[model samples]
Target: MSVSLVLTVMREAVIRILVVSGPIVIVAMVVGLVISIFQATTQIQEQTLSFVPKLVAIFVTLILAGNFMITTLKEFTEYIFRLISGM
Candidate 1:
C-alpha cells in the first residue's frame, strides 16, 4: 500500500482502539480516583478494596457496551476486508 493509505489505516486503527477502550479506561481511572479519595479519608488501605470495585465496574461496563463494541469491531473488520479486496 501507498504511504498515504498506510497512514490512513494506521490512523483509523488508533481511532478505533481509543473508541473501543476509552470508556473502560475512563471508568477504571474514575473508580481508582474515587477509591483513592475514600482510602485517604477512611485509611482503609486494603488491596482488595482497590481492585474489586474497579473490576466490577469494568465488567458492568463491558456488559452494557458489548453490543456496541461488537458492532464497531465488525465494521472495522469489514473495512479491512474491503481494503484487501481492493488491493
Candidate 2:
C-alpha cells in the first residue's frame, strides 16, 4: 500500500479498536480503582482483591457488548479486506 493508504488503514484500525474496547476498558479501570481504594481504606489487602472484581466486570461488559463488538470488528475486517483486494 502507498503511504497514504497505509496511514488511512492504520487510522481506521486504531479508531475501530478504541470504539470497540473503550467502554469495557473504562469500566474495568474504574472498577479496579474503586476496588483498590476500598482495599486501602479497609486494610483488606487480599492479593486477589484487585483482580477478581475487574475480571468479573470485564467479563460481564464483554457479554453485554459482545455482539456489537463483533459486528464492529467484522465490518472493519471486511473493509480492510476490500481495500486489500482493490489494491
Q: Count clashing residue pairs per candidate.
A: 0, 0
Per-residue lDDT tens digits of candidate 2, residues 1-87? 699989998999999989999989899989988998999899998979888889899999999999999999999999988988897
Listed in order, each prediction's TM-score against the native is 0.97, 0.90
Q: How do the residues 18-77 of candidate 1 rate in per-residue lDDT, one tens digit apiece?
A: 999988999999999999999999999999999999999999999999889889989999
Stretches of model 1 off by over 4 angstroms after superposition:
none
Worst ten-residue run, lDDT, model 1? 65-74
Query: What is the clash tally of candidate 1?
Result: 0
Runs in model 2 deviating more than 4 A are: none
TM-score of 2: 0.90
Q: What residue pairs are clashing in model 2?
A: none
